[model samples]
Target: MFLAWQEIKKNKLRFTLITGILMLVSYLVFFLSGLATGLASLNREAVDKWQASAIILTDESDKSLYQSSMSIEQLNDIKAKKTAVIGQLNAIASNDDDKQNISLFGINKEEFLMPNVTQGRAFEKANEVIADESLKDKGFKLGDTLSLSSSDQQLTIVGFTDHARFNAAPVLYANLATFHQVKFGEAADQKKDQINGIVVRDDSISKLTQNDELDSIEIESFIQSLPGYTEQKLTLNFMIYFLFGISSIIVAIFLYVLTVQKISMFGVMKAQGISSTYLSWSVVAQTFILAFIGTTLGFAFTLVSGAFLPAAVPVSFDLTLMMFYGLILMVVATAGAVFSVLTIVRIDPLKAIGG
Candidate 1:
């Protein structure tokens, strides 16, 4: 350990250069990780907040919650410990010709989870809407009337909530009846009681044995069926994995070349009776120190960048992921050191000493 430290101190420029490269690589990986996680959250924040153990959608819909429709009778047939009806629609909201695409969700006022009215009461009457804080930022205020296209009903914002977004759009909560009316227009009267699906709080229901043609699936299973969630995750994971592999290879090659250059020194030490085990430990210690310094700097950079970034840019840090990735970086760095140290054991002291 002492020898390793002395060597690193003697070659400050070389060591610093390697550390800088490592830091840059780690920074990219960490930053991309946060971006991926943040985007995923933005895409599915509303559904995640439901905290429901399962969601039931029409089997015939093939795992599409947005398209699946469950009649009121089917919802009643679902005997779960706890359940709530959910409806989803996408439409444009216009005020004075300023329009924004919005994701509209319908919930039974009695069973809605999350967004528990930070300002005003939940939707209690038809045509009343509770929206996210973004609405205020967009020049909307409580009691302000907004019109939905293709509908005669003029919706009124009744409340504002935080942390409520869907598909990257601010969520607007309304009563199932109103949502049905807005979505189906006149047809809503004949199917006023229907819902898109049932959100289950527990998994006590027996494997579905329904004779109806509709499909049923757990919430997670349903999310996996979304158009691009799985593919996006896979793509991000591949990039992260590739970065790790590159880091490992770069470290291994650098350390191996450095070790080869120090072969004579190692030979002299071994000839003086220094055990290969102690030398290997020294190499590993140096690797640990380097990785720790590099990754720490990288983490700091990520936090600083995140601080200065605008709110519109999505970047989030999950402590568990940070720790896990840190550990992975350490392991790969240490493995590289080990790969280099193996060459030390193969050194022949006699030839090194010119015997």
Candidate 2:
């Protein structure tokens, strides 16, 4: 460690440049991670808030919430500690000249799936609704009436709830009756009790996995089934893994070049009685030190940059996830230093010094 520190001190500019590159690479990884997480949360934030274990939809719905349709009687067959009926549809909510796309959800105000009102009281009557706070950006607020493009009916925003977005759109939560009215219009009464799916909690999920009539899927799987969700997640993860590879290569190349430049010095140290093992450890120590400093600074940069980002830009910084990545980076950096360590171990004192 002392030797590593001394070498870094002697080549401050060179080491600083190397550390800067690592820091930038780490920052890019962390920032992309935040964006990926934020996008995922936006796609499933409403469902996640339910804290349910599984969702039950008709077997033919292909695990899609929007495509599923079933009668309310299906709930009786589902034995769970907690269950909630849900109705969903896509619609544009417009107020005067302003308009926004949204996922309209129907749930009983009394159900556990109902979001807690953050700005006003929860909806208590038909046609009254609580919406995701994100709608506020589009000039929606308490008591504002929004017209649904799907039907002639309109709804009043009774309150706003935080983190209630779905599929990257704000959600409007209303009673099942209102949802039926909007979804079926003049035939509303005919499908008053129809539902998209059932959100279930605290049950042995495996029990319903093989049902002939319904598809029961874990919440995580349900989230992944969202349109384009799996593809988006896979793409971002590939980028992160690619960056990890690049990080390893960058560290290896820097350390290898530095080691080659100082071969004569290392030969002298070996001749003076330093063991190859000690010299190799010094290389590993240097890699760790540089990685630690770079990763920490990169994390700090991510936080500071996140703070300045606009609310419209989806970015959620999960500290635990970022920390795990940071640790992985450090490990990769150490792995990269192996080549340098091997070079140090193989140095022939006479040949190196004579050269």
Candidate 3:
């Protein structure tokens, strides 16, 4: 370890250049990882928050939540331990003549995973709505009237919530009856209580007794079945894997060539009775030092970048992924050091000493 430290200190310029390269590579990997996670969160945040174990949709709708529709009877038949109706629709929400495309979620006021009334009361009437704090930036406030397109029935912003977004749009929550009326117009009868699908708490329903008209799937499975979800995940994973491979190869090649250039010095040390084990430790210690510095810098860069990103950007930093990447970087770096040790073992002490 002492010898390795001395050598690295003596060749500061060369080691610095190599460390810089590794730092940049690691930074690129972490930055791309953040972007991938952010994009995925934006695409699936609302669905994940539901925390439902299963979902029931129409079998005739080709397995798409957007296209599936269920009647009151179809929803009730699938009820198990706990069930709630969810009505989804895409429409425009306008305040003060400024309009934006938004996803409308019709939910029962009594059931939801993370529903907290941050401000004002829950929807008490048919044309009331609650929205996220982000909507404030678009000119909406409590008691403000927002109109849904082509509908004479205007919605009042009764409350605000947090962390509620759907498919990159701010979610507007409304009572099931109002949701149906806004989406289906006068065709939706408030007295008859109809909804799009039923969210179930479990999936242990007997297959033989199940209704053939409705498709029941686990919530995780249902999210995976969404269009572009699997493909986007695959693309992000491919990039992350490629980055890991590139990091390993760069470290290995740099250390291997550095070891080769110092073969004569290692041979002379061996002639002086230094053990092969000691030389191997020297190489490993140097590799670990380089990896530690590079990875730390990369992590710091990610935090700084995240700070500057807009709030609407959905980057989420999970501790699990951070630890996983750190372990991976260390393992690959140690493997690179092993490659360098192999070259040291091949050095002939007698020739090195000119004996």
Candidate 3 clashes between residue pairs 3 or more apart in a chain or in different chains:
none
Ranking by lDDT: 2, 1, 3
Query: Which lDDT value does model 1 have at 347?
Result: 83
Cα lDDT tens digits, model 3, 125-164, are 7888888777887777899888877566688889988767
**Which numbered prediction scores highest in TM-score against the true structure?**
2
Give the candidate order by descending TM-score: 2, 1, 3
TM-score (all chains, Cα) for each model: 0.91, 0.96, 0.90
List candidate 3 stretches off by more than 4 Å: 149-153, 190-193, 203-209, 353-355
What's each prediction's clash count?
A: 4, 0, 0
Q: Check candidate 1 and list the clashing pairs.
A: 58-215, 59-214, 59-215, 60-215
Scanning candidate 1 in windows of ten residues, the lowest lDDT window is 203-212
lDDT of 1 by residue, 15-95 (tens): 887788788888888888898898777667777778777778876777877788878677666667777888887777877
> Measured by C-alpha RMSD in angstroms, how accurate is candidate 2?
1.6
